[model samples]
Each structure stands twice: as C-alpha cells, then as structure tokens.
Target: MSTVTLQEKKSYRIMGISLPLFGLITVGVLTATYMEVLPKGMIGAFALMMVLGLILNEVGNHLPIVKDYLGGGSIVIIFGSAALVTYNVLPESAVEIMSNFMRGEGFLDFYIAALITGSILGMNRELLIKASVRYLPAILGGVAVALGLVGLVGAIIGYGAKEAILYIGVPIMGGGMGAGAVPLAQIFGSSLGVDSGEMLSVMVPAVALGNAVAIVVAGLLDRLGKTKPNLTGNGELMELENKKAEAKEEVEEKEEKTAINFPMMGRGLLLAVSFFTLGSIIGKFLPQVHSYAWMIISVAVVKALNILPREYETGAFQWFQFVMTNLTGVLLIGIGVAFTNLQQVIDAFTIQYVLLVAVTIIGCVIGSGIIGKFVGFYPIESSITAGLCMANMGGTGDVAVLSASDRMKLMPFAQISSRIGGAFMLILASTLLRFFI
Candidate 1:
C-alpha cells in the first residue's frame, strides 16, 4: 500500500505556522479575547496582533487589484486593523492592551532602534558618507516645493493660503503624528493664541490622509521604476559611478550567504538598544532635537569612523533582519490600532483639503526628484525617501512608505527625513505662525 511521506503530505502555512495550527491558535486567541481572559502584556498583544496581521496580510497580498496597486499586504494590515477598530469589531480591552504595548510600552521605538542601528552599521562606509551630504538638500527641496505649491493652490481655490500651508501643508510634511502634528499644533496654538487641542483636531487628519497618500504613491513609484528602469536603483538610493558601490553589493551578497548566528543577533540587540540609550541621553541635552535623530547621528558617526569591529556590524545587520522579517506585520498592526483614526481621515476628506494635500505631495515628488537627480541619486528613490517619507506620518509612516515602495533597505534615509526633516518643519511652522498670524 502507498504511504504518504512526511514531506509529501500537503500543508499550508501562515506566518510560519501550519494552516491548521494557525487556525487553532486564532480560535484560542478569539475565545480568550471574547471571554476577557486573554493574557495581559506582551503575550496577549503579540497573539492577537500576529493572528490578525497574518490573516490580513494573506488576503491583501492575494487580492489581484490590491496586490498590484494598493501596496499589497502592508497597507492591508495597517488599514484593515484600523477599520476593525473603527467599527468596534475588536473589543475595547484588546485595543487598549495592543495600544499600551505598542506606544505606551515602547514597541515602536524598539523596532526603529534595531532598524536604524543595524542599517547604518551594515552599510558601506563610503556610501554612507557620500549619501549623507547630499540627502539634506533633497529634503529641503521637497519641503520648499510641497509647502509652496499647496499655498498657491489654496489661494487659487479660496481656501486661504495661510490656512492651507499652516494646517494641511506643514503637518503633512512635518513627519508623523507624535513628532509632527502634535508639536506643530502646540507651536501654532501658542503663536496664534488658540487651544492646542483644537489645532490638533485640524492637523491630525491631514497627517493621516497624507500618510495614506504617501503609501499609495510609493507603490505607484515602484511600478514606475519597473516601467522605466533607469529612474530607480532598486534599493540603492544613489547612482554612484564607483567601484565602492559595486563592492557594497558584493558585501551584501556575502552577508546573505553567511549562516545565522544567534549569539551574534543577541549582541546586535544589545548594541542597538545601547545606541538608542545613548541617543536618549543626548536628546536630554538637546531638547529641541528628537532622540531618533540623535540615534541616527550617533550610529552614522560610528559607522563613518569605522569604530566597531566587522563582526559587530554583521551582528547588527542580522538582528535587524530578524526583527524586520518577524515583527514588521505585528508593528504595522500596532500602528493601525494605536495611531490611525479612520473616522478622522474620513472627516477630513473635503474637496479643498484633498486637493491641497494632493498638490503638496506632487510638489514633494517634483522637487525632490529634480534635486535628487542633480545630486547623483535615483529620482524615484530620492522622491520616495526625501519627499514621500517626509510627507508621511513619521516613523510608522516611514515603515509603511518604504514597504509600499519595496525598498526597506532605504530605512536609514527614511528615518532621517522623518526625524530631522520633521524637526526642521516644526521650526519653520513656529517662524511662519509669527509672520502669518
């Protein structure tokens, strides 16, 4: 009689769990959640997020139109979770636990810390140095154009130019929510003698809608790159005509071939957290600057100086890969649950607001693309990083935008655009409020 071998048996998997096992786990999680007996903290948070994220990811990636045009699984996990919460499909207690774990308990920071530390250290020293010098100008170009275009459009439509720039334009390009809208609201409120909460109510929707637009545009850019191959460098930001660039690719290939080292990843975890801690300490002294910007500076300095041993760099990269591969879906779900407000996004969809937001994003693309090309960087990559990333919602937006663009390797530059560029926008908003108000 024919017998089925273990390998020959049919099996399906979702997020590494066999199909049946995944279903059972899902049932258990749902049962516990409904019974109000789900374990607290990380255990419960992870279980719910993983199950929901994986399911949404699978559905999103498989749907033909969504997979092709709408940013695939990443967008789905984010907005799907947001929709669930908006409809109150998930219990309030579950949302609270997830939100606490993600924001209150600092899961988002943990994810970003690993990405920044590992991505910088793992990069070629020469490329890192060359790219850094040119990045700022590209960012500035995007900012100038986005704000200027939106202001012009607002004036044309009788929407009040100052209102457009201050409310919609600044917040859209200001980074994300915590680092962008929240601070910008305070600045505007204090300067104009208005309540910060009231100002925030106006700015929050712009940030959210801008974030959504950035993700969609990133996917379109990815498609454009495919159609016009010369406009993009795949994951590489710059189009360098040097052997060093080639050498970087070889190093990356070698890294991929290297065996997984658990101990190395452990060391990587420690190094990432330590660097973040250093940034936090530095941020205390420079209260104006975000700790993330400080962390990027610190990590970049170390990488540029070649201060660490080669093994440590490898460790950091490995750890980053581990976190990115496993936790990204979870993190996206957290963002949707904790940060996104579907009702607010809907409320802010007036024609004038939508038109102004569209203009700002377009200006960012045109401005960053032109300047980036001038600076030897690929236009698509630059626009995605210095432009769309700047226009997105900050750290969480960075993740979504990069994921939509299929350029997760561009995380370092994306972070720079979010943290540093966002800080610059805050300063600009404060100065402009004095002039406009």
Candidate 2:
C-alpha cells in the first residue's frame, strides 16, 4: 500500500473528484434556470444555497467534509454559481427585482474599498527604505500629473458618453481606475431611475476581468525577470539585512513564550477591521476621491501615528489581500451575470474592447520599461518592474508581482524601485483622476 501525505490529499481535493461535484451542481442549476426549465423560485433557492455553501466551507475548515474542498475555491464556487444562475435564468423584470432587494440592503463597497486601500498603504513600507527623497518625489509627482490628466479626460467624456468613461478609464488607471467609478455609476443609475445594482454588476465584472488579466501579465513579466541576474541593488542588501535582524529577534521572542495567553488572531483581525472601517467612513465623505487611495492614505497616517503594531498576527496581511481581491472578483462576476444582457454580451463582443485592452496594456509595459531603463535597471529587471506598474498602478497585485519576480534574481533595488513606482501611482493617479474626470 502507498503512504498518503497531506500534500497529496490537498492535491486530490483540488483536482480528483470533489471539484467536479461543485462545478457541475453550480453550472447545471444555473444553466437549467437560464433555459427556463427550472422553477420560478430558482433564484431564491440558489441564494439560500449560497449561504449553505458558505456555511459548509467554514465547517469544512474545522472538520473534514470533502477533504480539501472547503478551502478558498469552495466558497467562490458557491457564490459564483448562484450568481450565474440568477443572471441567466431571470428576465429583466426578475433581475430588477433581485437587484433592487440587494441594493436596498446596502452594498459594503466602503469597507471593501477601505480594505483594498489599507493593503496598498501597507505595501509602501519597502519604498521608504529604498529611494532617495529627491527622485521618489519626482516620480510621485509624475503619477499625480498623470492621474489628474486622465481624470480630466474621464470627466469630459463622462458627461456625454458615460460607458466610455468607465470601461476605458478604470482598467487603465489600475483596474478600479477612478475614485468615482463605483460612486458615479451608482449616482447616475439612481438619478436616471435605473437600478444601481445593475450598473454595479457591470462594474464588478469589468474590475474582475481587469484583475485577472493583470495577474497573468504580472506572472509573465515575473517569468521573464528570472532569466536575468542583475535584479537587485545596494538598497536591497541593506533592507534584507534589516529583515534578517528582525526575524532573529522574532524567533527569540517566540522561544521565550512558555504560556499561550495572547489572543493573537483575534487582535490582528480586530485592528485590521477597525482601521478598514474608519478609513471607509472617511472615504464616503470625500467625494471624487478614490476610495482605495484615501484608505491607503488613512492607513499611512495611522501608521505614522504609531497606533498599531509594526506587524500583526501571522498571515494577517495575506488574508486581507486574498479576501479583498477574491471578494471583488466574485462580486464583479455576479454583477455582470445579473445585470448584463447575456445575448447582448455575446453581440457586444467586438474587436474594439480587445483593441482598447491591448493598447492599454502595451502602454503600461512601454511606459514602465522606459522609466526603469532611465533609472539604470537591467532589461529583464526593468521589464518586470515596468510590467508591475502597468498592471497594478501600485496595489497588492504590484506587491505580489514584485515579490515573486524579485526572488528569482534577488534584485532588491530593482524590486523596491518598482514597488515605489506602483505605490506612488496607485495612490496619486487613481485618487486624483476623480478631480479631473
């Protein structure tokens, strides 16, 4: 008999048989409903099903349900499946009814937005250590200028052609490009007596689509960076040394711990949640300011005040990043399916969307690449760094991209430089775009 390891079990859970059960059930129910073969209350049924699915996931985490099926992918499948069913099965009348109910419940965009902002803010710590004040300021200033100019363009065009303002600007700015993307869309939908949820449905998918694409692009760039050697610089070395020292101290502290009295996970979650909530409330009051940008700024301000610990519990940042991004993704897909006309989506598939996407991506790559070269970064290093900037405009995606890519070459300076670029642009450009637009 063969011995089974935990890793093998995880792999089996991810692929072997259980995955199909969830996928089939979700897709089958959705497709049947869309075909009008299912009962009228299919949407409601699915909604309840989603709750059950989430509960199952949480339970599975503590117990062993379908082996490894209770992990992240399980919840996503449950939520996404219900959304697909509702979108497909329901007519416009039904969709409007459901969307109205959801809208009335009040979306948690503020909290979600703030969490995203906090993650971005947290990513900038590496920048303060690497770049000189002089050049860093200049780079940030450029980003601010870019954001303002883009925002102005969005505003000018938004008055006449709102769709263009959204689909075009959001992806270019950093996926959730404009400060006003969600709010303006909501406001406009409300004033026109349209269901704001429908618009949000559209916006969420667009954001998710952009994020998925950005991840792939970042991954490709990371792979390219690995082929080169000069990926880091002198600044990186110093930063690494400091990190090692800190790690050593942390190890010693852990060894000294004989009692387990600390509420480690609970405290970390509370602090993160509190900061996120406070930041979001502040964001709602600031019209035309990008929520994420404001959130990042708020976190930075709080950090500067020295209120929270330098680091919270283990994997807190990772959890925050994953939850925020995944939630954003699922929400977008649900919105897309619910509000968009599936037939129209098929018809609307044009070369234009693809062309726009391509040009935007190319612009990001070339622009970042040029800047990196000027800073004396090697070709591979510059390419990856530029790729990070182009894809994220400085968010969690940027951090992930750089961290993964930098490890291949250990190009610490290049890594920091790219991070700084991303941070500066995400905060400055995305936020400022609202004013001009």
Candidate 3:
C-alpha cells in the first residue's frame, strides 16, 4: 500500500494536475461570467492571474531553449501574458477584470511592500552595511555608460547622438514610472518645447522595452556566471573570507536550540510589515523621497543598533523564504497583464531604436559589473542591482529582474538603484536637456 501511494505521488497525472485544473477553472470562470453572473472582482482577477501564471511559467521554466536564452519561466509569464492582452488574444471582459484587479485594487503595491520588507529584514546586518557603502558608484557607472553607448549607437544609426540621448536613451535609463518618466515628461515639455504627453508617449515605450530586455539579460547573466565560474558570489554580493566566520557562527547556532518555528515566521512578517508602514508614514511627511528609501534607512538603523535579536531575524528570514517561494509567480503575471503594454513595444519597434536600447542595457551591465568588482563586490550581483535595476520599471522592474536572476536577497541594492539612482537620473535629465535643446 505504501509503495502504491509513493508511485501515485510520482505519476504524471498527480504531478501535472495543477496546469490542467488552472486552465479549466479559469475558462469556466471567464465563460460563466460571460454567460451569466460575472465573477468580476478580486476573485476573478486572482483566478486569471493564477491560471495564466501557472501555465506560462511552467512552459518557460521547463522548455529547454526558452529556459536558457529567454530568461527562464518568469520572463515568459510576464511578456507572453502581456502579449496576449496586447494583441487582444484574451477576451475583453477577462482583460478588463485582470487590469482592474492589478491596477485598481493595489496588487502591485501590496506585493512590493511584502518583498521590500522581507528582503531588508532578512539580510545580514554586517553585509548590508558593507554593501550599501559601495553600491551607489556601480549605479552611477551604469547610468554613465548607458548614456554614452546609447548616444553613440544613435549617432551611428543616423538617429543623431543628441536626439537619441534626449528622446530615446534618457527615458529608458531613467529610474521608473513615477520617479522616472512622469517627471521626465514634464522636464522635456518645459525645456525642449515638446508636449509633455508626446514626450511621455515616447518615454513609456523605452521604459517598458528596456525593462523587458533587462529581465532577459539577467537570466543570461546568471547563465554566464555559471559558465565563467569566477564572476559571481552565487548570490552573495561580496567575496569576503567569511567562511571561517560563518563556520564559527554555525557552530554557535548548533549549541543553541535554534530551529525555525512558525512563531518566528510570524514575528518576521510583523517586523517586515511594521517597517513598511513606517516608510509609508514617512513618505506622507516627506514626499520627495520614496517610501522604500525610508524603509531601508529604518531597517538599516535597526540592524546597526542591534535592536533586534537573533531569533527575530531568523523568523524574518523564514517568512521571507515563504513569501518569495509562493508569490513571485503571481506578481510577475500581474506585472505582465496589468503593467505591461505589448502594443507599445511593438509599435516602437525599429532597427535603430532596438539597437540603441540594446546597447544601453549592455552598457549598464558592463559599467556596473566592472565598477562593482573594483569596489570589492561580486560582478554579477553588482550588475543585477545597478544595471538591471536601473533599466527596469522602478520597484516592479526591480522585483522581476531580481527574481529572474534568482537573487531576491539583493532587494535592498535593487531598491537603491530604482529610488536613489532614479532620482540621480532626474537631476541629470534637467541638466542635460538644456544642452540638448
């Protein structure tokens, strides 16, 4: 009986059940809604995301060619699902339901908040302090190189260096939506005598395209690290001789009754949420800086002061693992369905335009990796934070890129790139727009 039970567990019928059930349920819900009373609320939205997410992700991760060059299942789920809506492959009612749920219902914000809290609290206190000091230079390096390379590509393709930098490159390399393009549209409007809406129309495409490319490149980078063997710390940002120290810590841990319990996970969740709340509260008072920046600051201070004990920290780590393991897929689908517009990417497609954006992302990776190595950080880790984060769509982009790279623990650096590095681009845009104009 036990042998039979084990065999059943390993059967394809049991293992592959999730994908089929997801499809059947999603179709049933959407069809039922169309036929009669609509399941047109949060429940319906979640249903679509889960079904679509599970199916696309399974293919992306399992397919040999796609898992390699296309940046694994996460990217597949995001862009493929996005293409479905963009091309109108999905029903109007289905699209509307998903869009309303993702955008109107605050799904993205909730996901980001959870991600930020857990990643920050889960980091090593000493490592966090060390990494924060040097990560900024890498971000600046990415920005500088991206601008230069993109401008050069533009000139070579007859796009003109100055025109390319102002219209094409700047927006792609800018921080993100709220912090990047929205304000940049205003800057272009006032300084270059272009309509803000027109500038925004140009900028949003660049942002979305660049973000998509960044996620793909990150997967490629992870593969590159596996091949090169010396470029990454696996997931660690530093290559310090901490092995002995880690071993000693492990020995110390064994002496104590330190096992991960549910209470610990709960405490971690509470701590993470509390910090997120603090950042939000601070954002209301000081609207200039993003809530994430404040949250990082608060968490860093708490870690620095040794206010939190080892037990709480462990709980936070466990909770973080749980959240990441479960929700990364769901959120990626939300980004694709709700946030991305495949139509814009398709419309903006041109050889010269594509080359400019491609070089811009490459420049970011090369610039940040080299600078990060020089400043005592892992090259792959640095690029993921400084380059990929800079190129992605602010917070949402940060999560997607990081998830694709399989390095969610690096969320602090990613946020720094999106928030602080993004702010720097705003300043650079103001200064450079005049020269271009």
Deviating ranges (above 4 Å) for candidate 1: 1-8, 133-136, 151-257, 376-437
lDDT of 3 at 340: 59
lDDT of each: 0.79, 0.42, 0.71
What is the C-alpha lDDT profile of model 2 across 1-437, one tens digit per residue?
Answer: 99864434443242233544545655775565456454334354334334334434444345442222212233233334344554554455434433443344333453344344444334434344334432343333333333334344435544222343344434343324222234434444533457654554444433433434444565565565555435433213222444455443221112121222245434445655666567557768974544445555665555445545545523234445444543443333334434444443344345554444444444445544555445544434444444433344234334444554543333333334333343344454444344434
lDDT of 1 by residue, 1-437 (tens): 98965445478777656777777889999999888787889999998998898999999889885664445676677779989998999999999999899857878778878877886677667645555577888998898899999999999999988989999999999877655665566567656777654576677667767777888899999999999999999988878673244555432312334578999999999999999899879968974555665776788788879999988898998998898788878887886787666666567679999889888999999899989898878999999999999998666678878988999998878877875677567667756765785
| Residues forming the 10-long window of minimal summed lDDT in candidate 1 | 248-257
Structure candidate 1, residue pairs in collision: 175-394, 176-393, 176-394
Give the candidates in order of lDDT, highest first. Answer: 1, 3, 2
Name the candidate that leads on TM-score. Answer: 1
lDDT of 2 at 125: 46
For 336-424, candidate 3 gives per-residue lDDT tens digits of: 76665566556667888878888889999999999988877789988998888998877667877888899887776776676557656
Give candidates' CA RMSD values in order: 6.1, 9.4, 7.4
Q: Which stretches of candidate 3 lie over 4 Å from their true place?
A: 1-7, 12-40, 87-89, 133-140, 151-260, 369-437
